[model samples]
Target: MIPNVIRRVEFQYCKLHFLLRTRPLSHVMYSGSTGLVTPVADPSLLDCSRAAAQDVDGFAIISNFVSSEEEEQLMVDIRRTLRGRKYLYDHWDGAIEGYSETEKSNWSESNTPVIQRLKAVAAAAVTDKVVVPLEQVHVLDLAEDGHIKPHVDSVKFCGEVICGISLLSDSVMQLQHEEYPDRWIHALLSRFSLYIMRGVIRYKYTHAIPTNENSVFKGERITKQRRVSVISRTQPVHS
Candidate 1:
């Protein structure tokens, strides 16, 4: 019993260390009962998995999940793989243009370490018992003028959790509730940051990156640039 207790404590401590790399500038949530928006003071996981009344439920982010050196190396791998590839301008919303995307069923030998690192951090950050990365890794490159419009992932495509690593540049992603438009939050994704969306936020909120204007977070304007994201989603569970 004593040895089991010790192992549990160690696990929690390691999970905390992986999550609290940087504080979020702005991560507010809507209070359904009071009909007011409240700030999620800290999103760090303290005890085992569940914490009491800590509002920011489905969305979480670690500002710096990977080191600068690792980020550069990922970029190197991306460029090598996507050399001379043509960007697509086809989308139903017509929200994105001059963007290139590819799905990697498996990572190369050089990228396996980083991929494993992402999986490890993702498992530690969320409350879910099982977090399985999908077979394909979604690699998306947005040109200087490209941005993602507000949209939700198809239920058939992926499961409850979506984890992504921001590479090359910093940007802002806004989440607005589908029913209550006023209820929203802005997540500032810094370079090399990792953002995870699950449960309610994944199904209900529509996320988008604005291109026409500067993004505001904590009263600071964020300008977008050429950005690349290495994203992985869990396999969709059939209901």
Candidate 2:
């Protein structure tokens, strides 16, 4: 028998080779300059099909959460808002430890720019599908070099349910813990895809995207596309 190490490497290489030849790369997934197993038929709500991918805590990845027309419009709106605005070093500080107070202060005034259509669609998903009310709403715009480090959002300020929609490009977001540093839960945020994090996914596993040049998925190098994410949360709750 081949050594286990060689076996693993050979298996992964074969898998990767098969994927590259059989599936079209999704510019939407890493941005397809490129593609997965069967996705749910309608991802407007949580689908049991992805239950296996969820960690004990809980996480959901919804593909085609928004239509192509909506995505195009959202991109226009996202670019407009992103223009002429000064971006800060980190938008995640408040969601993590120690900076809860500072982050909470901006919450009230921040929802003004989020497009109504986008907000309505997300809220509909939450209320109709997830059966929860919408709460905090904001955007995280990633520059070519921008990415939020691995950090847990503070439960003291943010709510239990967190939902977000990607715009402009595709990027990878990962979840992992210090205890199991070697294991990572990755969500490929394709443009217009919806990602919801709650339960263990929210409180336990820390999530982040590496800085632009450092981005990768499945051991493959990827380009950083300027990403605009509209994120919302419910009232603060115990996670």
TM-score of each: 0.74, 0.60
- Score residue 1 of candidate 1 by CA lDDT: 53
Cα lDDT listed for each candidate: 0.66, 0.52
Clashing pairs in 1: none
Query: Tens-digit lDDT track for model 1 on 1-239?
Result: 54553454355436443433333212532222232323445443111112212324567665566667778878888888889998776775576676898887565555665575555444543443565667778898988788788889887878777878988888888877788755676778777767777777788888888773756665677787889999878778787
Candidate 2, residue 28: how far the Cα is off, in Å: 18
Which candidate number maximizes lDDT? 1
TM-score of 2: 0.60
lDDT, candidate 2, 39-115, per-residue tens: 23322222222333445325655565555665666556555555666656544353322111111113211223223
Local distance difference test, candidate 1: 0.66
